[model samples]
Target: MPKLTFNIFPKEAHHGDESVWSNLIGGPSSFSLESRIFHSISICLMGISCFYIPYNLYAGLYVASFSAFIFGIFFFHQYYNSRFNARKHNNTVFGLIGLLIFGVNYFANSGIHGSTDLIWPAYLLLVFAITPYRQHLKWLTGYLVFFIIVHGLEFYYPELVKYPFLEGEGQFVDRISTFPIPLVVVYITIKFIRQSYDREKKAAEERAIAVEISKQQILIQKQQLEDSNSEKNKLMSIMSHDLRTPLINIQSYLELLNASEVDDEERPVLERALLTSTNNAVEMLSSLLHWSKSQLEGPSVHLAEINLLRSLQVTLDMETAHAAKKEIIVSYQIPADIIVKADLDMLQLVVRNLIANAVKFTPKGGLIHVIGEVLAQECKITVTDNGSGIPVDKQDKIFSIKAEPAIG
Candidate 1:
């Protein structure tokens, strides 16, 4: 079956209240504040003049009617320039037009007693609203001087001022008709100014928020750098002290080998001691080199599947001499088929360090165990010793660099 649909409004009209309002305000972001203000005020003045031009003619003031007609033409054309011609409102002829027309309209349409007096301040406000701030004082002073001179000229030369309105009744009628122009002028100007102020305030707040976020990120980066530097200092202190111990052991063994009274059986023991010292030095140096690399390039992991027993065998063999020195029974059991995925360098480093620590702290003839277990989701390799272990309270600090208590 075919269905029919109907839309009441045109697709363009469906753009909603904001879109319509934006067009009224010269498409929001497209127009400058001055341009939009000029356009808005022009529309308002054109409307006011439409009513006054007819009203003035009907009231028998031909001079005021002609003045309104002139103003209507000016507002319409200037509105055209602001909306379509100029990118921003820079017209100053409005002020000159006001001065010229109002000057003639003043004398012809009952001088100081006419509606021109009511419209003067409103026109000045419109001029100030569109013009630059630096020109405000100049315009204000010029308008003030013009007002005083024109009023003074009429006051001294009474014959120059004409009376179009007859008496109090005519004056009252004139005031009523002329009042709305200034009222609408003040309203439009103040409204646009307030809206502009609120927008500037919101933009300022967003800039402040962005600056604050950037500062916080910079602070975080600074703290990380400080922590890294602190760790580097701690590592150097530990390495400088630890690295000397194995070197001293090797030096003493070499000195004994050079002695004349060295026995045949003692040679084997000395060689074993030398091997232990060499292994310790190699492992420690490897750890130091890895630490230096991490500081320079940051950390990286390369994961791959590897046989657990095959990986640990070389490391275990290196530790055999150290174990023999204390007569510590070091044993490990892992199924040959126990495969795990890991970064091989990082894995070997961790295991070598654990076994070294075990051999360091364990008492004479202590049993140190290295065991590997495949759990439901993961693999666990543990190196443990049957020596006085860390106290429960101190145990948690083992992996923490800041408050790491001594092992022995």
Candidate 2:
């Protein structure tokens, strides 16, 4: 025996919304307007057909046509009102009204004595095609109940079924040969309309999220600019106060030296004082130049492969005069063959600043040591001094703008 497979519900149970069904049922406001216009035109056409069907002078046909015109006007108003109000609420009422009109018109024109009975089923089919998903079960149940009552009555009272009133029975049987076809078409249409609405909703949500992200990025950039401006203002204040004091003192000392009424012994002592002042002025000038160059255009370097040992030797030689004046001994422990690619001028500035700082802060007979080593893909250089070390509290601020020498 083949294995039994049980499906508790059809695959359609898992199926969701569809656009085609929504469009038929007037899901969107635009589609509802279109459907309303279509319905109005169909009713008008039917009224014209009634006017010419059997004889043009029939009062019943004229009355039916007039009824269609009134209903058409009603449909137009419902379309606009539903659109103006919310679509969901109006569409529900619109579908209900359409069903009511179809049923009433069928009974009015093809009452017990009419000749066009086949028209009722066709009108019933139109309702099934366009009714909203929510109204499906109601439409089907009502149709089944009506069909049973009409056929039962016809069987009981055969005289009540007149010539045109029962004229289209054969056509009704032929049309309904494919019993479940309309139901399938309606289901597919509903599923399609729902999917379309879901896709549009998702795309709108994504666009909103992207806009929010862009706004946050702009805010972050604005904050960074404000911080930079604050830093620049603080640096300018320090430059103005610190640089002006030293220059003023040098000028005062020079003016005093210009007077020519001094003894030889006093002159020697004054000359020594002048020399010390000149040295202090030079130190201040050097600091200003270094700081200005670093600020104005950053450090310029010519990158090339250079021997680390040779570079250190050259740096020590350049600082020999300054080191001797301070009684500082500079030494290096670097491998001779260790080479690295770097800008010579930049490395020299780094080495000079470290060594000079050491000499400035060191006491007499203090020693300075330079060390270098090659590591994977990079090189490390360190300058150590046996002098007064920087205080722990000031270490974090050493590379900050607060530690920069005054400029102007």
Candidate 3:
């Protein structure tokens, strides 16, 4: 005996609950429209089949038509309820009712003539096969029960087999015995196709997600590398600029010391050079520390309205000794009321660098003038020198990373 499995049953247990099946069935009125149209056609066909049954030759047609009409009316009412109220209960009940109507009709119609009724079982098998797998088990059980009852009736009342359609039917029982086989084959084929489609969709979604994640990671790494490179460039610029002046002063002082006699009058001049070198080195270190702090920690601006003339006076006073030793005359022309919003430390560094550069490049007796003016929205501080001014061609490249002519 072939063991019955859930797969073999006519109507499958609703395995996935109502939520799952609702998604599969889609929204309300979608399947209902189709069901309504099918039932309406079947009702029309049943009415036509009744007319044909008047002729004995088409007697079995009436029975088929009557069965179709009964099932159609039940299905039509179910579809009507489902469409109006959006309910699954009606659909489930209608399906069960369809199975019962078809089963009973098949047995009654087949009793009169076994050969003509063989096709009824084949029709039932097709309907069960085409239905969704979740509903197949229940229908299959109904089919089995109907089959056993019909077969028993045929055996007990052999006189019911005298219809003309059975005379030339040729072994009706044997020919239709394996009707369930074709249904099983079709069900398996559909199930396989659906499973394969779902697997491919899932794989594609996973691949898309993986690709997106990779793109985000690459973007993050690129940003980190750019930030690191920027910091390195800033550090190198600070080191090169801050170290140049002190090293030059030290070299000049050492050369003078080595060339001159101990009793020479230029000994005091050499001592002044040493003092200037030490001061320049200290200023450079301080400037570098300030720049580094600004870059690393964050903006630390302490704004104040400072008198431009007073600030210039203070800077010139600080650099006066070095300027006198170099024969560079420091002068200033500014309005007393000129004020600007600035952070004192940062403005001092800016002015100091400009003054130091002027003294370094200016020849003996060259004049270094600090000028200040107030515009409508901004204050202008200018450091001008009579020594060799920056060449026109090198001015643009002064801020470049390569060596360039100095500004006086």
Candidate 4:
């Protein structure tokens, strides 16, 4: 004898919010959408047949045996399709089973005037639930036309549909036994629909959040690129102004030398003036190059201890000579022993620009002062001149990018 196995309740392993059944069957045959519905319907039919077979045997063994065979075929079809085919054939299989078995059962039980009338509509509901929406009209039209033909046959040929029982009691038992099948179908169908809806809604919400995050990241990247371009433009503007000033002085001196006659004594002085302008241009070019490299690759700072006076000595001497032509008094008060931690090139360029700006603004014979003070743990450097002071209204903007160079 072959052993028989029966598993009415589904067993599944849980992974996060999903189960093994959802992973395996949810693609082609979703548990909440298709497989679960088919399984419930299959089990309901088999369970009903357990009671249906014995009851119909008393009425007639031929009817009971045929019902059993139909039930067996439906059970195996659902089982095989659910496991191997993943319920891909659910709509066609269940539609055929519902149409053929319920149609024949209607006449076999008692033709058009039986409990099959109550069960037929419920079976149709199962077919509608399992099948795709496109097949609805086709199946409904087929079932309705078949129903009309069966009724017409009963009216014209009364002998075709057999009445299994002759009285009220047999009819009562048959009707009561068939009631549970339709009820179970309705309950499971509703459950599967609700579960499928919830799953899809959750997936939609996750996708929406992911899209919002991507949009925010794109906005941040756009802002960063705009800032980078703005900084590059500002640096280029300042470089143009500073670089042009020294080159203009060099070109003016060269033109003057070409146009004018010079004695031996005056020629050396003009050459020294030209040499000073050339050195200023070279210093400005070096600063511009360093600034450009920093902007390109980001700033790399190396700090070391150095005497502040020693570092500024060459810069101060150069500015004094440059200012001597205008008769401006340039003086400094930094101690020879005063030391500070700084990047040497950056510190030298900063000091040179301050003095140069002072020389550019001061009138002939104006006094300029350079002072450095060490207080507690801080070193303060100040550049002051007796040139026209910045106006009160413009003082706040003196350090801003909009601080334009004024004509002396």
lDDT of each: 0.78, 0.55, 0.58, 0.73
lDDT of 2 by residue, 1-408 (tens): 122232335355346443332332343435443343333334333444443433312433444455556555665555334333433234455445545554444444444334224444544445554566667778767766765666566568655443322347633432352233334433444444465568789989998999999889889888866666655555454345434534555565566567676767677776775676566556645654565455444334557998877765645654544565567787878888899898654566567667867776788888998889877888898889888878787788877755754211
**Candidate with more favorable, higher lDDT: 1 or 3:** 1
What are the per-residue Cα lDDT tens digits for candidate 3 across 304-329?
98887675554566565457767778
Q: What does candidate 1 score on TM?
A: 0.67
User: In model 1, which runs have C-alpha deviations exceeding 4 angstroms?
Assistant: 1-13, 24-30, 87-90, 159-170, 236-242, 276-408
Candidate 3 at residue 283, lDDT?
A: 67
Using lDDT, give the best candidate's number: 1
- lDDT at residue 401 of model 3 (Cα atoms): 44
TM-score of each: 0.67, 0.41, 0.44, 0.69
Lowest lDDT 10-residue stretch of candidate 2: 1-10
- Output the worst ten-in-a-row residue range by lDDT, candidate 4: 1-10
In angstroms, the error of model 4 at 196 is: 4.0
Query: Between candidates 2 and 3, which one is better according to lDDT?
Result: 3
Superposition error at 109 for model 4 (Å): 5.5
